[model samples]
Target: MKAEISQAEKAENLSMTNWFSLLGLAVAVLLSSLNISIVNVALPRLASSFSVPMSEVQWLVVVYLLAMTCFMPIAGIWGDRFGRKRLFLFGIGLFFCGLIACIVSESLTQLIAARLVQGIGAAIFISLAMTFVSDFIPATKTGTAMGILGTTSAIGTALGPVLGGYLISHFDWHALFYVSVPFCIFALLLLARQLPDNAPVPFKLVKSGRFLAQFSENPALAGSLTANVCVSAIIMSTMVVSPFYFTDGLQLSPAQIGAILSVGPIVSALTGAPAGKLTDHLGSGTVVRVSLWIMLLGCLLISASAFWTSVPVYLFALILVTAGYAMFQAANNTAVMTEVKEGQKGVTSALLHFSRNLGLMAGASVMGWLYLFTSTFFPATQNQPATAFGVTFLISAILVGLAQVMVSLRKGR
Candidate 1:
């Protein structure tokens, strides 16, 4: 009786610690995600203040994304060698310093440089955050934990524009950077207190190579990563193209376009927890397959909306795509992380993020170019933008279809 009671108490204590750790991790996720989105609203203001063209100010956003992508893999390797908690603390501190630099910057060059520093710090924590679920959460609840992270991320994405607008309106553009400082401090303190330190591993470049080589041996990991890249590309493409489509094709005002665009992140936030529950009950593989089908269907609907010029159809399709993405993200992360070899969790997580950022960069450039190229071929008398939108989404659907086929073939084999 005494032993049973002791075991029960230990379990409860561990559970409490896990929840606290998760809270810290969630805050980190929110901070990183908010930064990704919050800066866009300030770009015009920044350009005016710096006396530069929009093209020059745009580098502030692009440089951050580029730095995050470039640094993530290295950060992962360092996390494993030096201890993730220590590295994560360093990352938060670096991010705080970057924010201070951004607030005090006198030139566009200085602000862009500060953003690069911030991105590197964001990369470190974002890559390590998923690994924490594997470390601290019970296996059965992994999906739910991932879902919570997804929800936090979606909330940050959804809130960034609104919050940035409010801050810029009431205060100054610098307030956009200032808002995150308190949250970063809180995350640092909570994580420092709650997370247990892991034993440091010997650093090796060969280990990263060996981990990459596992893609050939581990079909599940390969398929999940491939799907991640494709889905991320498709999602980013929608974000990049949809506003132009709404304006040129549907003839909507900027306010209406903003309202419509907001639906995707809102739906993603709303669906994240439920999707995670579904993943737990249905299994990650099953949830992934279903989510892909949903996304494909949504893409088709989006294509149809281009032809019909129906706002309702577009809204419904956005909900489906975003909700499906939320589901896929939770299940896919669970699947990929589940297959990580011992001692490689940090690198594996980093690779997952790298694939996503790569996809986003590709989608922004390639998809926009594709839309422009296709638009030129259409007659001016026709709804050229709408036709281009339709064709672009049809191609996106094909990509999603290809991913589903790949996953199916791998499962069959």
Candidate 2:
């Protein structure tokens, strides 16, 4: 009886600690994602305040992205070699300081520099957040934990524009930075108190080489990573091209276009937790296959909308695509992290996010250019915008189809 009771009590304690730790991690994830979008809304005000051109003010966003991407691999290696908990705390603290610096900055240069600091901090924590779920949560519950984190990320992303707009309107641009301070403090306290530190692994250059060799040898890992890149590019392409389509092809107002565009993120947020659950129940491979099919269908529908020119069809297609992407994200992330060799989760997780960033860059540049090139082939008729939109999505569908083929071939092997 004593042994049984002791075991039960210990389990309860662990459960409690897990709960608190997850909360801290969730808040950290939210902060990281929120900052990415929140800063965009403040660009005009920043330009005016700093007396700089919009192009110059844009560097604030660019610098942060660059810093995050460049430092991610290093952060991951450090997290594994040092300790994830310690690094995560350090990241949170650094981000907090960056926020303070942003609020106090008297010039655009100072603000941009501060954002760089925040970006590096974000790279550290965001890279490690998924690894924490893998390490601390039971394997049986990994899907559910991943889903919760996914939901939190979506919420943060969805909330950023709305929250930033509200804060900026009511107070000032500085309010955007101020709003996160309390949440950051709360996350730091909770994580410091509840999260357990993992033992540090020794870092060696040879081990990294072996990890790379292992990655190349593992079809699932390589396939999943490639799929992530393709999916991110597809999503970013839609974001970059959709507004023009809504305004020119659909003849919609800004408000209507915003409403339509917001649906994608909203659907993503709603789908994340359910998708995670599905991933758990159905297995990552199965879920990923289904998600790719759903996305492919969405792309076809979007292409059809060019002729249909129906707002409802466009919106439905957007929702389908976004939801499919969210599901794929959860399942794919789980698949990749599950495949990581012990003591290498940090680097693997970082690589996953880094691939995503690369995809976003490709989508913004290459895919956007593709749209422009395709649009030029169409004569300047009233339907020109629709035609370009259709062609772009058709190409996107082909890409997704190729990804599906790659995944299938890997599975067959």
Candidate 3:
């Protein structure tokens, strides 16, 4: 009875700390997400300032993604080797440092370099944020915690363009970089105060060549990771092409494009809490099954809607797609981390991150190439880009559908 009472007190303290940690991590994830979309609005300004070609200026975004992509897997190991808190603090510090450098950058090269630094920090912070939740929160509450994190990310992605537009109009484009600094500083402070400095648990490093195969030794982990990568690929395929569909094909203005794109993230943010509750009640399996079906349906709807020239129809299609992705992502992430062994949390989380980013990179590169192919081979048709995008979505859907099969085939824990 005395031991039972002690365990209950410990549980209560952990619950409070978990909530605080979630708040801190969400802010960190939000700032990182903000940097991704905010700069899209500022690209033209950046181009004019440096007198660079649009293609050259695009590197500012591309480089950041590539840097993050390359660095993300490494972050997982760092979290496992160092404590999650130490790595978390370091990552946030690096993000702000990079932001500061970006604000003062004079040349395009300098800006790209600084953004790469920011990407490295972002990769570290994001992976650790997920792993940290698994550390502090109980298994049952994982979905809810992830839901909050997902919502914060959605808010950042949605608000980034609107905020960037305002700042670029009244202030120099550089202010966009400076804007995120204070929020990150606060996140770092909160994390330090609230997060426990639990010592790192040691483990043998898994090689990239052996990473997937060794991890696949656990059927559940393999299934979860596979599903995550497939869903991520589908989401990114639509996102990468949507701007062209809106601006070039539909002839919307930049602000209108921002508004249209904003709808998905807005709905995502709104639905996050509910999705969390569902995950908590239904478990990650049910959540993923339902979410994937929604995503699959949305993909088909949007692909068909792309044939039409109506703005409202397109926006509605996008909202459905985004909502599906939002729910799918939160549930999928919760599922992925929970399937791993407790001591393997960092590596498992890292492998999952690596897989997702790897999927995005693969999707973006392959889908972009397909778009270019269509533009060259089918240039006479006005619907060529949509056709190309639809084809990509169909492939993505099939992949995700296969993932569903794997999930169904997966046995008990």
Runs of candidate 1 exceeding 4 Å displacement: 1-7, 40-58, 105-108, 164-173, 203-211, 244-257, 372-385
What lDDT would each prediction earn against the true structure?
Answer: 0.80, 0.77, 0.73
Each candidate structure's TM-score, on Cα atoms with residue i matched to residue i, is 0.87, 0.85, 0.86
Model 2 TM: 0.85
**Residue-wise C-alpha lDDT for candidate 1, range 3-38, written one tens digit per residue:** 999999999999999999999999999998788666
So what's the TM-score on candidate 1? 0.87
The stretch of ten residues in a row with the least summed lDDT in candidate 3 is 205-214
lDDT of 3 by residue, 40-90 (tens): 655556667788754576677667767777777678767777677888799
Candidate 2: 10-residue stretch with minimal lDDT? 205-214
Q: lDDT: which candidate is best?
A: 1
Between prediction 1 and prediction 2, which has the larger lDDT? 1
Looking at model 3, the pairs that clash are: none
